[model samples]
Target: MGSITLTNIQKSYGAVHVLHDINLAINEGEFIVFVGPSGCGKSTLLRVIAGLEKVTGGELSINGERVNDVSAADRGLAMVFQSYALYPHMTVRQNLAFGLENAGMPKAEITQRIGEAARMLEIEQYMDRRPGQLSGGQRQRVAIGRAIVRRPTAFLLDEPLSNLDAELRVSTRAEIAALHARLRSTMIYVTHDQVEAMTLANRIVVMRAGRIEQVGTPLDLYNQPANRFVAGFIGAPHMNFIEGALESSNGTHMLRTAQGDVLHLPQSVAPGAPITVGLRPQHISLSNDQSGFAAQVQLVEALGSETVIHASAFGTKLLAIVPGQRRISTGDTIYLSYANAPLHLFDQSGLRIATVQTEDGHSPTFV
Candidate 1:
C-alpha cells in the first residue's frame, strides 16, 4: 500500500510560484518517473512528496494517509539524491547500518538488514571498503543500498544516474529497473532525460514550466501526442514541423505548404486557416526523383545502422532518417516523400488536429 496522491499541489517561495495545480495519483507497486527540462519543478514535486519541502497548497497522501504535515523521516519514504550522500569516512557496511542504528533497531536485525541489502545490490565484496575506495557506480549502489535498508513505502530517486558515465549510467539504469521489479514497491524517479523516463517508467509524467504537460505510457505519448509540445518533445531526433495553411477546394479540405505544395486532407478544416504539419524523420523516405519536394542537404550523419540527413525544405530545416550508410554528402539535392504514414496537424493554438489525409483526397479518422 505504497500509493501516493497529490491534490491541487502548489509550491511557492513568497511571490514566486514553482509547482502549479499538480494533481497526480500514483498506484502502489508502480514505477513512475517525472521528466522535464531543468527548473520545471519535477524535483520540487518529488521533494514535496518526500516532505523535504512544504507545499504552499494542496494535500499529499501516502496510502490514503495525509502526510503534508509529516516530517520527511516520518513520511514512510526514502530518497536517493543525485549526489551519492554516503559518509566518506564510513565503510559501506557502516553506511548501510547507520540509519538502522539511529532508529534503535536491535544489533542482530541491523546486521541481517545490511546483509540482505548488500546481497540485493551485489556489493558484498566492497562492503568493508570506505566510500573513497569505491568507484562512482559502487558509491551510488551504496547510496541505493542505504535506502533499501530503510524499506520505506516508496523510493524517491532524484537524477540518481546523472553522475555516472555513459556506460555506467546504462548498466546502473538496468540495475535500478531490476531492483524495482524485485521490490515492487511504489517508486517515483525524477530525471531530465526522456530516454531514462521512456525506458524505466511504467508511466511518464512530462512536465514543463511548473505544470504537467502530459501523462501516459511511453508509447501512448509517442504514438499519439496530445499537443505540439509533446509531439516534438517525446521522440529522439524529434518530430519535424513544417509551416502550412488549411485550404478548401470544391468542398475538399487540403493543406498547402509554404513552398506552394498542396497535400490532400482527410478532414475539413476552416478554409484559409493556418496550421503546422509534423512529420517524424523515420516516416520520410528519400528518393532520387525530382518530381516531389526537393531539399538541399546541409549535413549528413552516417550512423552505422541508419543515416540521418539534415536538409532545408521550403526555407525550413528538416531531418530525414534513412536506412543504412548512405553515400550522400553535404550540399547534395534529394527528393523526399512518404506513404501511409500519419501526419500530425496542429492548429494555430498548437493543439493536434485529428484529421488523417490521403493521396486520393479521402478522409480517414486517425486513431
Candidate 2:
C-alpha cells in the first residue's frame, strides 16, 4: 500500500527549475533516503511527493493510483519537518490528537492511537507537557508521535534531527531506525548529512544540482560509485583524486600521474587519454621503505582508535587514515602506498570507467 512511483518528475519556480526529470520507483516497506548538498532540490522533491508542491511536469502515483492533483491533506502522507512545527499553545497530547479530532475520528480511537504512539516513541512521560517544557530530543520524539497517530500511507521526514546536538542526533537517529524496523512502513527521509543517510537507508538516492546522480544501497554507492561526484560525496573523509593519463608500455596498460608515479591499470584504454585515479583514505597505508610515493605531512589528527594524516604527494594533496597510535607529527616526511588496493578510475568527464575482470574472474588491482 506504500508504493510510490515518479516518472519524469520536474519542478520549477517560474523559470528556476528545481527538480529535473526525476524518475524513481519506491517499493512498499522500503526505507529510502534522499541525500545531497544544500539547494540540491531534495526537499523540493519530497514536497512534491507530499502534494505540497505541484510538479511542473511528469506523473506521481501512489499504490498504483495517480495522485498528481491530490491536495496535501488528502494525499495520505505525513511529513515531519526540521522545525518540529508543534503548536506552542497545546500539550503533547493535544498535538497528537489535533489531526484526528479534525478528521472527526471517534474520541476513544484518538485516545488509543495517541497512547500507542506516545509509548512507542518513549514520550509517554512528556504527554502532558508543551513543546517549550520538553528537551530538543524529547520534543522531536513528540513531533514523530504526532505523525504516527495519523497512520498515513507513507512517512516523509525532512531533516527531522537537524536541530539536535551531536549526541542527541545519534540517539534520535537510532530511535528512528528502530521505529522503521517495528512498523516496516515506507519512509522517505531527506538529509544533507551523509552519515545519517548511510546508517539508516535501505537504498540511497544521491542528487546533485537538481538531477539524480545515482541510486543504490549504501555499500553499493560506497564501493562502486557511478561517477566522481557520488564517490566523493558518499564517504566521510572522501576520496582523493590524482590527475593522470593512461599509458601503455610494452603491451601493459598503466596510469602515469602528473608527478611521474606509474600505477598498473586493470584494462587498456587509448594511450595518453586523460584520467583521474580515486583512492580512499582508509585504503592508503604508510610505507616503511622508499618503495612508494614521497609525501610531506601537513597535519596529524590522533582520533583515539585511528590516526588521520593530511599530506601532499606529487604536488597533490592526500589524506590517509591508519589504525592505532602513531608517533607521526606535522612537518614529517612519509611515504604512502596503496598497492593491491581497489582503485576507482574516472575519465576526463568525471564518469567512472568500468573495471575489467581477469581470466580468474577477479578484477585486477592497482600495484
Each prediction's TM-score versus the true structure: 0.95, 0.95
| lDDT accuracy of residue 27 in candidate 1 | 98
Top candidate when judged by lDDT against the true structure = 2
Using TM-score, give the best candidate's number: 2
Error of 1 at 98 (Å): 1.4
> Which tens-of-lDDT digit does each residue in 233-333 have in candidate 1?
88888999887888877877777887786766655566788988787888778765655567899999998899999998856899899999888889989
Error of 2 at 178 (Å): 0.6
Model 2: pairs clashing at backbone N, Cα or C within 3 Å: none
Model 2 per-residue lDDT at 109: 100
- CA-lDDT, candidates in order: 0.87, 0.89
RMSD in Å for candidate 2, one decimal? 2.5
